[model samples]
Target chain A: MSTVAVMNGNYAAATAARLARPEVIAAYPITPQTPVVEYLTLFAAEGSLSSRMTEVESEHSAMSILSGASLAGARCYTATSSQGLALMYEPYFRASTLRLPIVMNIVNREMISPQSVWGGPQDSLTLRDAGWIQIYVEDNQEILDQTIQAFRIAEDPRVLLPINVCYDGFYLSHMTERVEVPEQAEIDAFLPPYEAKHQILDPRKPMAIDPLTSGYLVMEYRKKHMDSMAAALGVVEETDKAYAALTGRSWGGALDLYRMEDAEYAVVTLGSVTGACREMVDEKRAAGVRIGLVKVRCLRPFPKAAVAAALARVKGFGVIDRNVSFGWNTGIVYQEVRSALYESGRTLPSVPFVGGLGGEDITLGLVSKAFDEIVAAVDAGRTPQSAVWLWAPRKGVKA
Target chain B: MSALDLLAEREDMISPGISACVGCNVELTLRTVMKVLGPNSILAIPPGCMGGVGVVGWNKQSGAKVPVFFPLLDNTASMLAGIRLALDAKGRDAHVVAFAGDGATVDAGFQALSGVAERGDRIIYICYDNEGYMNTGYQRSSSTSKGSWTSTTPVSKEGQGGKRQHGKDFPMIMAMHDVPYVATASPAYIPDLVRKVEEAMKVKEGLAYIHVYNPCLTGWGIRAEESISVARLAVKTRFFPLYEARNRKFKITVPVPNPLPLEDYTSRIKKFSHLGPERIAELKDLAEERYRFLEAVSAGGGGRA
Candidate 1:
């Protein structure tokens, strides 16, 4: 591994793409994600990279460029966040359906309803069905490390799906941190050149791509897509193990269960908030409370089984959601964990805590309060509801 | 001109079993474009006749020897820019051509096209102007010329519901970029079309625009065999002038003759058959007015940057 002095999340991502040597880099400047493309252009200008950078008018066009590039048998990369991802809605779905192994890094931010630009997982979660393999990173190091692993996981012949490596806006993207960038030869041996089982434009042979078909054909196509996605679970596992061997860092499967084995109470969350929750767990344990934390690294192909195993023995659970499902009463993660437990033929009274949305600071105190709620329920020998909103402020607290 | 003989011996680049409908002018347009671009080009096709005709299945391609990248309908220009970039990264310089129908070019794909051209990505953009959304079954498009009857522009009992807007002036728009090359040709004028394509291919930078006048036999209700003849008549009647804009200068390739009356152009196609005598006269006057403006431009200095 090589130590680059220091870099922001966006530049690190761009450097990762450069090291991976993607053939096509299509990007349009959007806030938070803009510096990624700008740095890529800098790399291109200095002749440090050989990839082509397309100046697209919008995020929609940026994704469309990757779709074409992917078909042409190029390892393609793009960057966007918030409304940019929303603008790319149509082709984003197409890229995943076609199962092109394009890699993209999304600096996650909240979508506009009341109209604000701040950080959250809402944008990437909203694209949950886009058939993209979504991985959330906790810090700049994870951002750089996961960006490299993402290409391996997505381009795995068994998977053949697009990947979105999500990091939080401003918090992770703009912040500087020390990251270990692996050697070019190390990446070369680990990831390998992208050789597709099928390419849209191979002159040696002829084929048809994207034919319009009847409803039944589309259904079968969807089934095949789902089957491929299901197949990706194994590919992701194998690639993570291989990555760990090469770097001495094992990012346990889709979800990482931290200290949940013997704990009576657990809290689950994604992204950098995992660090704060872990800290809260340490602090609560010093006070002699039996509490643990679960960090969901992969939000898509969600580790339902992993979560079930982690929470099977726990008495009470709380989910820290940095984003809320507008129409739902509780947090989105709470709904997923609840459904997973229900599907697994087990029950855990999980409280949903919504906080840190739109760049709001998710303090350890807030997380400690959630632990207090969960521990009180378990100690009182009372089962909480299937889910309850934990940190929603009361009317008097509003300032 | 001898290149036509060389092409004659080669099998038609677009294979016979492709999905283009029987007697569709797009078939000829595709054949002509493939011949001009040769076997080494990469085509960026979006939704419309060209896209439908080209892509058949995932990883399945048509008869063209070169690669064709089909992006979403509205993003042909941007995708072509990407294709050019991809090729450049490999140290391989090849033509990146965006071939889309009038609907894809003049409507949804407009903003992307504008961006790519302004960025001057090395791509050749061709709008096969068939004047309507023929693939989706004869719906109206921005390129549907005034007085044309389409499924959406049904002929009324009072005969007033033809296309309300004039066809968009794409060549003018391309010229506005002061691009290196912008030319208009028809399948009927094969030699001229081939010459323009050859010239555009030699240009190393910036965008090259070619607008091909493709006649719609099904939508326009003309004989399938008369597609070429109809396009030729369009040029002769000054309804579709043959011209080239290079470095922002417009040169009328086909000088206006004692230009044939609008009737000579309209009477042949059933689309314009709905026109009354008075409407025909109005159409004739509009065509002449457009011709005079173009002629004056040609006479003074043929637009040049």
Candidate 2:
């Protein structure tokens, strides 16, 4: 008996975490992510959630508790956004390298300096090089589904790397949507109890954890850890296949192709922006336009091969990045996709359009402007030399 | 049971082939601690010398008899709290202990330490206060005594010898958290330290903070054999008074009625060799201030600073 309730993104995420029955949950409050923590504390207080809720002082301790708990061989869950994630970088860096399969929800928000608490992917995007697997979702239902799947993917023997289930903050985290919450038993069947095969804190064993290493042995650890990321590419497919077999809803591997079969031009998007682009693609398809959308779900172990294969035949493509790469003068995802395509030796004229920054809306008009740029690049037989900024004053620093 | 016999009954938890220098006081403290706690406890060691970062480096053997978790540098308190809470959730009463250095406890890790104490999380949080960032070459820490030398606080030509502020009264600060157990111990007095450990183990509820004065031979520029003597003189001079805060009321566990002069303790360690008479008098004044504060707490006046 699955409960289908209209729930906000935070509730959907909290609901999934609750059903997973994490042994330990720790988190600190930041805007857009605070509701998830609040809901978890209430669940723990009301006895609806059976887990040790560690109300830590800061996000650093929040991730630290999860790290220690996971080392204790307990399934742990936590969430944070923007500065909270920034504060927890210490433990966050260790969680993946130590191969602790802890699942954390990242309600994407803008980083500070300008001091904005709105939705943007800049937070998680900044940590793209960090060892954790990054999964961006398009909607609340997908948020609920992918969170449960994140545990399976992170804990799989092939890839015992931690994963951040990132979704747009206000757009998805605050927006309400009808989510089909699965039954506890069904989720239990999908995701088995977390058994730490990698490392465990057992007094009986009396082994050393994180001992100091010289350069030679340190290379082996680094290589082995990196090898796990490549293996994640395969584990992600199989895990999603297993989930698809259960729920009859499958996100097309890492790069979800939308009306791309024979399209002459394409636009790539991630997080919540993918949903709006999907609507645009459907409209374009109905009007006999050759435009399509490519939803990028996995940012790390970046579905390079899949992305290459999807866009190999297209005349041109554009990447809509909600985050800036700073010095590169383009979006972070656009830079990644361009690198992936370049590595694959596929030369398609590309448009790197950065919009929806700092929770600024990436409306249909802005997306249309992006699509036009991609088509213009293809028709002119040239790629844009720099990124096109949308929905902003014309007077900011270039890039 | 005799405390000596109780200590002798247990095996040496520190592997004999460990990397700690001879007469390392931290090694003595760890061995004595493991002897009392037995093999049932779990230790959450952070990136500190005691956890094998610098002085007593851990390798495959790790010199541990029980499970040891090395949390990040500033996360020992949260890690211990997490491990203990996780055990409690599983209906296990296994002891959780945090052995951290001054850098991890008094300064960088203070927030998490205070947070867990407010929650009254059951764990033995021992700050092996060697007084500075000893493992990182004796830089000044919040626990470094006033008028003492450190890499960051060197003697200047202007006649300044060391840190200007008094060494933070960390254990007293912990007592202010109103925790069930807060005590200061020194490795120089084994039986007293063992007694405090036993008492903390008995209470077995809420956070138990033990600020153990661990003399660093390398960092303090003292002879390895002088570690214990230096620690003993520290207590004899009333510089590091051995006391316990029970139910927010303080009591001097080992009182020194006719305390030795501060020079007796300062003379044993090279870290304080540059202190002039003026600095020595200031040091004596700070210890007196601490004594007055301890006396107020002993009279059940809430230990107000």
Candidate 3:
């Protein structure tokens, strides 16, 4: 039996990790992600979490510790946010390349320059190509559910790679929502204890890991890593179906569609902004406008087929990105969506929308405005060359 | 058993032939240390002389009989800590160890090592301090001695400039962390080094760190035949004293009561050839001051039981 409890996103992530029963957990504290580490340590202190927890000095050590633990055939977990993620980049990339099944919750916060720490997916999106399977969640429940499923997907023999379950900071990380905490027995039944087969650092077995390799062997390792990533797409869907069957709740595999069928236009979104977009989709439908919402859940090993197929029947679509793709003049996901469309041999009228940066709210008003632009582009049969900024001028403030 | 008998009887964990430079005492230190650690050990060889010489191996070949791997240069201690935790989780009793160089230890890898000490992670860390980044063409590291001429701290055409600062006292720093074991060993004193390694293995409660002072033959521009002698001079000159601290209780393992003149050690290495009388005297005074401090700590019992 599962217990439904009201908890914030960080607690939800921590609860999911506890249920998974990772053999080792090491994490350092960072804003937004700080509470997750606190909750985990608290669980360990209370004797509920039996994992050997290390209060690591830095995010670098946190990832390094997990990498070592995973290599030693132990299931491991950790959590971090913006700057912490940047600090762990070296070990983070190595974790995936080494193919360690470590699950990390990325409490997504914006990268600093103007120095804001509220909320954004820019942190994880900037590292989309770093080889970790990244899954962005919409709410606290999704945060709990996906983090639990993350272990299963990462430890799958066909897809033995590190994974990141990313959720927007403050928006979901601090926001309270009802979450279904799974029972220990249920989680044990779902995610079997991780058994390392490919590589392990054991004295009894005695084998070299990550030796100085020739260029040819390095290339072979990279090719195998890529193949595993491609294989993970299927594993993600299968795990989602299995979890849904056990829990009666399924976050759509890679891309979750809301009223996508029989709709002429769609607005694509990622992370917490999906909630506001979903409401706008319904609002537009009630006003007799045929529109739907496409929420991108899995960002790495991108669900190109599902995304292209979902947008196939629509006349046009608009992507709302909280993160920018510097040289492209649009958002990161907008470029990704366009690239996927190009690969599918389809060029339709589309609008690129960029807003909600540095944790500024992507309000219902902004999402509705984005949908209007998509509808306008589809009716006019002309795609905009530049991004449509979803900006709202505040009272007594200049644009 | 005597240290010599133990060494002779124990199986060498490191592979016989790889590619360490001729007469590299760091290689000697690693082989001797691993023999003490034996087969029930998981070793982390970070990027340095040992790793570059293929201690962790090239391609599919392994450089050690025990499980060995190359940890990131700055993460050896934390990685070993993880290995320890995992091994404990699986109810396996194995020595989790790291054989790294000074560049990977006192410089980039210090924080992870210090954190492990503070956290009481049951792992053994052995740092082969050959003064500088020898594998990368003798760049200056924090562990490089004062007045030494590294590639990064090069002397001028007039032989006026060298390293401006003194090398960091790293072993003392680990001792201050009050871990279960902290020791400074030397390649010249095989018995002492062997005993320290054995002592480290006996530490089941917390981190056991052994810092070995090895004079680099290739990097320090010393004759290959003079490698062990030069390392001996370092100890005789009181520049790198052999000592150990168990839970803050300090003891000089191989005490040098009548130290040799600093020139005896400095004159042997080309990196310190540029040092004049005043500079050499400064080094002598500094070593004396450090030794006096160690004496005080040893006499005072490090302020705690």
Top TM-score model: 3
Worst 10 residues of 3 chain A by lDDT: A390-399
For model 2, the stretches where C-alpha displacement exceeds 4 angstroms are A392-399, B53-61, B157-159, B299-305
Rate residue B252 of model 3 by lDDT. 84
- What's the true lDDT of residue B33 in model 2? 84
Q: Is candidate 1 or candidate 3 better by DockQ?
A: 3
Best to worst by TM-score, what's the order?
3, 2, 1
Q: In model 2, what are the clashing residue pairs, if there are any? A: none
Window of ten residues with lowest summed lDDT in model 2 chain A: A390-399
lDDT of 2 by residue, A1-399 (tens): 677899999999999899889999988999999999999988888988998887778999988888878887788899999999999888898888888888999999999879899999899999988899999999999999999999899888889889999999999999998999888899989888888767777666665577666678778888998999999988888888998888877987687998889899999999998877888887777777799888898998799889888888898899999999888899899888888889888788888888897899999878777777788888898877778877745576664
Winning model by DockQ: 3
Better candidate number, 2 or 3, judged by lDDT: 3
Q: How far is each candidate from the true structure, as Cα RMSD in Å? A: 3.0, 2.4, 1.8
TM for candidate 2 is: 0.96
Expressed as tens digits, the lDDT of each residue in B65-147 for candidate 3 is 99999899999999998988888888888989999999999999999999999999999999999989999899999988888
Report the number of clashing residue pairs per model: 9, 0, 0
Q: What TM-score fits each model? A: 0.92, 0.96, 0.98
lDDT of 2 by residue, B1-305 (tens): 66699887888765666566677898788788888888887877677676663322243446566777677778888887777767776677677888888899999999999998998888888889999887668899999988778888888866566887888899989999999999999999999999999888976678898999987999888898788999898899989999998768788888777889998888888878888888899999999888877876684452323
Better of 2 and 3 by DockQ: 3
